[model samples]
Target: MILDIYKDALEYSAKDWKTLVILGVMCLFSFLLLPVFLITGYNYRVINTAVHGIINGRDPLPDFEDLIDMFVDGVKVVIVQVMYLIVPVIVFVIFAIVAGHFNGGLSTALMIIGGLITFILIIVACLMSQMGLCHMAYNDGAFSKAFALSEIKEVIEEIGWSECLMTYLGLVIITVVIASVVSIIIGAIFTVFGISGFALGVNASGVFLLGAFINSIVSMFIVGPYLSIFNARSMGLLYTMQI
Candidate 1:
C-alpha cells in the first residue's frame, strides 16, 4: 500500500507533467489572489480525489479539470478544518489572554494547564478532522457528514483505532522525513552553488534572501505537491481498509 501510494503520485505527476508544472508555477506566484485560489482549489481536489480513489480501490491523483467544483470543494474543506479547530483556537486564545493579563503563580499554573489541554485537544482535533474529511468524501462532499460522530466512530472501529492511529503517525513521519530531506538537499545545493559562489559575492543579505526564494520555488513546484499526492494516496488507502 505504501509503495502503491508513492507510485500513484509519481506516475500521476509524471503523466500530468505539463499540468503539474503549470500548477506549480501558479503556486509559485500564489501571492496573487487568483493563484492562491487555484492552489487551494488544487488541494481540495486532492482530498476529493482521495475520496474517489478510496471508494474505487485505486489511488488516483485527480487531474486539473472541474475548476469550479474543485474551488468550491476546497473552500468547504477549509471550512470543515477551521470549524474542527475552533475549540482549540478559542482555548489557546483565552489562555493567551489570561497569561498576558495576569502574571503570578496562579497565572503560571493556568498557563501550564492550558498548554497541556491545548496539546491534547490539538491531537484529538487532528484525528477527528481526518476521519471527518474521509466521511465528507464518502458522502459526496456533504459538509454535515463530517460531524456524524457515531458513524465515523463505527468506521474507525472497523479499521481498528490503534491501526488507524499508527498508520497516520507513520504517514506523518514519512512525510516529515521526505520534506526534511528535500529541504536539506535544496538548501545545500543553493547555499553551496548559488549563494556561496555567486549571490554572496554580490550581496550577503541578498544571498540568504535568494536562497529562501529558491527554496520556496522548489517546495511549491516539487516537494509540496508531491507530499500532497502522497498524503492523499495514503489516506485513501486507509479509508479503503475500512471498506
Candidate 2:
C-alpha cells in the first residue's frame, strides 16, 4: 500500500499535473475566502435585527447608521479565531469525501467509517513526508518517496527521531514567524493609512496584490505538498514502532 501510494503520487504528479495544480489552487482560494466569509456572516446585522424584532415584536427597520455601527462593533468583538478550528475540520471532511469517491469502497455504511479512517491516515502520512523533506537536504528521492509511508519511515529512522522532530519543529516555527510578521505589517499599513493606503499599495505599487498571489501559490504548491508528505512519513514511523 505504501509503495502503491508513492507510485500513485508520482503518477498523479506527472500525468495529472494540471489537475493537481488546479486542486491546489482551489484549496488555496477556499482557505483565503474562509476568514472573509466567517467575518461577514458573524457581523451580519440584517439577520440579527430580524431575529431581535421577531423575539421582541418590534420594528426591524433599524437606522442605517446604527446598523453599520453595530456591524463594526460585532466585527471587533466576534471571535474570528473560531475559524482556525472550523476550517481544518471542513477541509479534512471534504478531502475524505473526495478520497472515498476516488477509492470507491465507501458506499456501504460500515465501509464509510473505514474509508474515512484511511483518508485521515493518508493525510497524516503526507504531512509527515513534508516535515521529513524540510529537514533533509534537497533530494529528488525525498520528493518521490514522500507519499510512501514505508519509505518515509525508513528515511526518518535512518536520520533519527530527535533530529527529525527538531527539524520539523523549526520549519513550523519559521513559517509561523514569517506569517506573523507579514500580518503585522499589513495590519499596521491598514491602521495608519486606512482604505486609501491599502488601495494605493494594491493598485499603485501592486505590492499587496502581488503578495497575496505569491502567498496563495506557495501555500498551494510548496506548503500543501510538503505537509502531506511529512504526515505520511510520520504515520508510517509510528506504525513501525508499534510493530
Candidate 3:
C-alpha cells in the first residue's frame, strides 16, 4: 500500500509539466509571501483530489485557478498546522515549569523525562497534523474539520496505529537522508572550489554565484516543491485508506 502511494504520488506530480512548472515558479517566488499561500493552497488541492479520486479514479494535478479560493484554503492549512503545533508547545512549557521546581538528581531526572516526553509529543503532533490536513481536505476544506481530533483519531484507528506511525517515520527518514545528501553536495562544491561568500549566497557584487544558484534552483524549483506535493498526495491516499 505504501509503495503504491509513493508510486501514484510520483506519477501524479509529473502528470502535467506545465502545472509542475507553475508550482515551481510559485515556490521560486515564495519569498514574496503571497506565493507561499498559493503553494500551500495548491497542496491542499492535490490532497483533496487524491482523497476523492480513490473512488472516482485519480485526476491529473489540479490547475492553478481560483486564486482567491486557493489563498483562503492555504490559510486554513496553516491554521491547522499551527493548531497541531500548540499541543507540543504546551507540553514543553509545562515540563519546563515542573522541572524547574525540582533540584539535584530529581531535577536532572525530571529534565530527562521531560525531554523524552516533549520529543514524543512533537512527533505525535506532526503525525496528527498530517492527518488533520487530510481530514480538512476530505471534508471539502471545513475549517473546523481539521481540528476534529476525535474524527482524526478514529481515522488513525481505522488505518491502524502501527502502520500509520511506521509510514510517517519512513517519510521522516527519507527526508532526513535527502536533506543530508543535498547539504553534503553543496558543501563539497563550496569546499572543492575554495569559494568564499558563495556559501553566503552573495559577494561584494551582490550576485548569486554557482553554489547559491544551484542551491536555490534545487530547493525552490526542484526538490522542495516535489517533496511537498508528494507528501500531500501520499497522505491523501493514506486518508482514503480509512474508507
Candidate 4:
C-alpha cells in the first residue's frame, strides 16, 4: 500500500509537471510564514491568521504594525476549523453507509480497513514530515525522509519503542531551544538597528523571505527524495527486528 502511494506520486510527477508546479507554488504561498514563526517567535494566533489569509485569498503579508491585529484575528480561524470538522464526519458516515449497502460482508470490511490504513498513513507521513523539517532546520544536515513502512519498521527495530519515543522527544526539545535562541539573536540585531535600520541594511524581512525560499528548495530537492529512501530503510529495519 505504501509503495503504491509512492508509485502514484511518482507517476503523477511524470505525467503532470504543471500540476506539480502549481502544488509547489500553493505550498510555498501557504507555508512561507512557518519558518518566520519559528525564527521570530510562535504565537498560535499569528500562525492561524497567516493560514487563514492564505486560504481566504487575503494578502498574508505582515506589516509590522498589523502583526498584533492578525494575531487577534487568528482565534476566529481556529473556531472555523473546529466547525468544519463536522463536515468530514458526515461525509465519512455517508460513505460507510453506501459501502455497506452495496458491498456488504468481507469486501466492505476490507474497504473500510483500507481507508483507515490510508488515512493513518497520510497522518503519519505528515507527522514525520514535520519532524524531519524541524530536525533539518535545526541541524542543517537532518534531511526530510518519507515515513514508509520500511522506514517505520527500521526506526522501531534500531531504536526500539522506548528509544524511539525518547529520540523524538529529544528532537522536539532541541528544535524548540535552537529556534528560540536564533529568534532572540535575530530580534536583538533588529532592535539595535530598528525597523528603519533593517529596511536600510539587508532588511530582516528579506532574510526571512530568503530563508523560506531555501526551506522550500530543501523540501523539494532533499526532503522529498530522502523520504522515499527512508521509507525503504524503515521496512528493512522492521523486517530484521521481526526476524
Candidate 5:
C-alpha cells in the first residue's frame, strides 16, 4: 500500500511540469514568508482533492488559485502545527535550563534523559501534526476539527498504528537518502571543479563558494518543493485509505 501510494504520488506530481515549476519558484522565494504559506495552502488543497478523488475514483492535482484563501489556510496549517509542537519544545527548553544548574554526572544523566524525552516528543508531535492537517482537510478546512483528539486517535487506530509508523518511517528514510545523495553528488562535482581551478592558479575559495550557492539554490527551489509535494500527496493518499 505504501509503495502504491508513492508510485502514484510521483506520477501525479510530475504530470504537470508547469505547475511543478511554479511551485519550485515559490519554494525558491519561500524565505520571503508569503510563498511558504502559499505552498502550505497548496498542500492542503492537495489533501482535499485527494480525499475527494478517492471517493469519486479520480484524484487530480490542484492548480494554484485563490491567493487570499490559500494564504489564510496556510496560516491555519501553521497554527495547527505550532500548537502541536509547543509542548515538546517547552519541555525541552525548560529541562535544559534546569539541568544546566547542576554540575555533575547527575546533570549529564538528566540532560541525556531530557534529550531522549524531547526526541520522543518531537516524533509524536510530527505524527499528530500530519494527522491533524489531514483531518482538517477532510473536515473542509474547519480549523477546530484539526484538534479533535478523539477523532484523531480513532483515525490512527483505524489505520493501524504499527503500519502508519512503518509508512512514515519509510518516507523519512527515503527523503533523507535522497537529500544525502544529492549533497554528496553536489559536493563531489564542486570539489572536482575547485581542484581543477586551483591547479590552474585560480582561487579555490570562489569556486567552492559558487558551488555552495548553486547547491543551496537547487535545494531550495527544486529538491525542497519536490519533496514537499511528494510527502503531501502521500499523506493525502494515506488519509484516503480510511475511506
Candidate 6:
C-alpha cells in the first residue's frame, strides 16, 4: 500500500545520515572510469539487497560496504545492459546514417521512424534487462541466471503485463520529476547568483562561477544517492509483490 516511492526512499535514507554521506561521496566519485564500474556494481548491489529483504523479511536498505563485490557484480550488469541494447543501437545508427543521406520529407519521415523504433526498443531492453539483473542478483550473481528468458517471461506473466508496464511508467515519471526538480533548483541557484555576480563586477562573476560549481557538486552529492536508493527500493518492492 505504499503510495509514494520517493517519500519512502527519503525516509529510509534519512534514517542514517552517516550512511547517506558515505553513499554521497561514493556517488560523487563514481563518474571516474574505475569507480564507474563500482558504481554500476553498487546499483546491482542495491537490487540484490532489496531482493534479499523481500525474500528474508529483513531490512531492505543494506549498508554500502563491499566495494569489490559490488564492482564485480556491476561489470556483469553492464554486460547484460550492452548485450540487450546493442542491436537496437546498431539499427538506430544505420537508419540515422540513411536518413542523413536522404532529402526533404523522406528524410524527415525516416528519421522519425528510426527514432521511434529506437526509443521503443530501448524501453523494452531496459525493462527486460532489469528483470534479468534482479534475477541474477537473487541467484547470487550467476551470469547465466540473468539471461534465463523462459523464467523471466514467466515472472512477467505472473505479474501481469499491464501491471509491469504501469510499474515501468510510474518509475519513469517518478524519476523524471525527481531529476527535473534537482536540475531546476540547481540551475536557478546558478542563474540567480551568476546574474548578480555579473551585475556587480567581473570579480563577482568569477566568484559566482566558483560558487555555482560548488553548488552543482553539492547538489549532485545529495540528489544522486537519493535517487539511486529510491530506484533500488522501488524495484525491490515491485519484485517483492510478484513473489
Q: Best TM-score goes to which candidate?
A: 5
The per-prediction CA RMSD against the true structure, in angstroms, equals 3.7, 24.2, 4.5, 20.0, 2.4, 3.2
What are the lDDT scores of the predictions, listed in order?
0.72, 0.42, 0.80, 0.39, 0.82, 0.73
Output the better candidate (2/6) by lDDT: 6
For 37-140, candidate 3 gives per-residue lDDT tens digits of: 89889999988998887723567788788999999898888878888888778887887898789888888888788889889988888889989988988887
Query: Model 5: runs farther than 4 Å from truth?
Result: 55-58, 199-206
Model 2 worst lDDT window (10 residues): 134-143
Question: Which has the better TM-score: candidate 1, or candidate 5?
Answer: 5
Query: TM-score-based ranking, best first?
Result: 5, 3, 6, 1, 2, 4
lDDT of 4 by residue, 117-173 (tens): 556544444334333322222232222222233554454555365544443344344
Q: What are the runs in model 2 whose C-alpha is more than 4 Å off? A: 1-127, 131-150, 195-243
Model number with the top lDDT: 5
lDDT of 6: 0.73
- TM-score, each model? 0.79, 0.29, 0.83, 0.25, 0.89, 0.82
Q: Which residue pairs of candidate 3 clash?
A: none
1-243: candidate 2 lDDT, tens digit per residue: 333323332222233344335435545565675433332322232223322222223322223245445444334323322322344466657656665666445445535665576555544443453433322212322223324446656666765666555544544554566556655665556454445666566443455555566655655754454333233333322223212
- State which candidate, 2 or 4, has the greater lDDT: 2
Clashing pairs in 1: none
Please, what are the lDDT tens digits per residue for candidate 5 over residues 5-47? 8777767766666676788888878889999899988888887
Clashes of each: 0, 22, 0, 8, 0, 1
CA deviation > 4 Å runs, candidate 1: 1-15, 54-59, 97-102, 194-211
Runs off by more than 4 Å, candidate 3: 17-20, 55-58, 182-209
Model 2 residue 48 CA deviation in Å: 53
Ordered by lDDT, highest first, the candidates read: 5, 3, 6, 1, 2, 4
lDDT of 4: 0.39
lDDT of model 5 at position 47 = 74
lDDT of 6 by residue, 136-203 (tens): 87787889988898887887788777776677777778778977787777768767877886777744
